[model samples]
Target: MARRLFVENGFHATGIAAIAKESGVAVQQLYRDFPAKEDIIAAIVEADCERIADQNTLNTAVANKDRAGIIGWLTTTPCHKDESGDRMFLEIAAEGARNDRIRSIFQGIRDQADENISRAFAGLMDSDMVEDEHRTLAQAFMIVSFGSIFLRTLNQEPVTPASEKLITCLIESATP
Candidate 1:
């Protein structure tokens, strides 16, 4: 509910009272749950992080040292097909630009994602440790993922094909 409101009306434009009203919860109760609007936004982002940050598949592939499995994972963009979700993310990103708290939240997500991607790169190369090359490729992959989300949300064409191509190139180059 707050997610929808944030996407439609934006972070600053959407007030606690509005969210409370929209969610059919009393403002006091909402306050008890989330002291501030930032808290609500944090909750939303945390849920998204949990949903999208599942590294089990990658961990399994890495544990088994499956190069093909790692490549398959790398090529698959996790960007959801839901435009609303993407819009919500864009909104949060915009807020994060000016808000320190939001920026910290997003930074944490980025750090975790980078770590996971770097580990995956190490796995892809059958290396026990992540090298500088792996870290650099992880950073690039993160950019591609963010770019794909932005392009997809904007209804731009050729995002997937281009993103896939870039990812494949990255994977191929990273392969030993």
Candidate 2:
């Protein structure tokens, strides 16, 4: 409930009273669970990560050793459809730019993503592919994924198919 409120209202807009009221819990109980808005945001981010990590797509990608399949899975996943989740992720990302702890957490997530991509690609490509090339593709993939989310959130344009095409080209480029 606190996560929803924080995502909908942002860090500054959400209040403990509102969280307590919405959650049907005492304000003190809410405080006991989370001392600050940042804590709640962190918990939300953690939950989102866990959800993504536990997705069947990740399992399929690992088992099939398919780069394109992994990209397709990532593009089609509805994980980011939650408006509150999107808003909260953006807010924390922005805050990460200035906060060491937030930055560290964000960096950890990025690292894990990169590692996963590398593992996914290892079976699709030969040893001739360089680590830098793999990392570059992973970063590009992340950019496209996040850009699609933002564009969708704004109702500007749908970038998912375009991003899939871009990722396909990237995979080809990394091939031997």
Candidate 3:
């Protein structure tokens, strides 16, 4: 409920009372569950990262060292009609720039994501792909993927083949 509210209404506009009303929980319970709005966004980001890490397709691609598959999934998944998750992610990103607490959460998410992407890169490439190479590629992928996703969502554009090709090209360029 907090996630939905935060995504739907701007975080600043969504209050405890609104969340409680939307969730059918008492305000006190909501507060007990999450001490503050930052807590909610942090939890949401953490859960999202965990869910993506555990996604069967993601696990299979990583386990199989399928770089192309991961890139395809990352670039295409956010094109869904309901872009609430992507929007919330963008929201958190915007908030992160202005708030230290949100920025910390973003850093945690980035670290976790980097580790996962590094593993994937390691699996995809041969022994020549060292830890530093993996980190570089992983970080590049995140920068491009997240920036592109946020921009595309903000522009309300449909996912075009050109955009898909751009991601593929970017990933290929950074691949070890």
Best by lDDT: 1
TM-score pick, better of 1 and 2: 1
Off by over 4 Å in 2: 55-60, 63-81, 126-130
TM, every model? 0.93, 0.77, 0.80
Which regions in candidate 3 have their CA more than 4 angstroms from the true location? 55-82, 128-130, 170-176
| lDDT for predicted candidate 2 compared with the true structure | 0.68
| Candidate rank order under lDDT | 1, 3, 2
Candidate 3 lDDT over residue span 79-145, tens digit each: 3334787888888888889999998998898887787666665656643344887787777767766
CA-lDDT, candidates in order: 0.85, 0.68, 0.73
Q: Which lDDT tens digits does candidate 2 get at residues 92-154?
A: 777789877777777777777776665555535654243776777667867876776676667
Alpha carbon deviation, residue 63, candidate 2 (Å): 5.3
How does model 3 fare in lDDT? 0.73
How much is the lDDT of residue 65 in candidate 1?
96
Per-residue lDDT for 1-176 in model 1, tens only?
Answer: 99999999999999999999999999999999999999998899888877766677778889999888777667664544567777877887788999999998888878988988898899988899999999999999999988888888877554777888888888888878
Off by over 4 Å in 1: 156-158
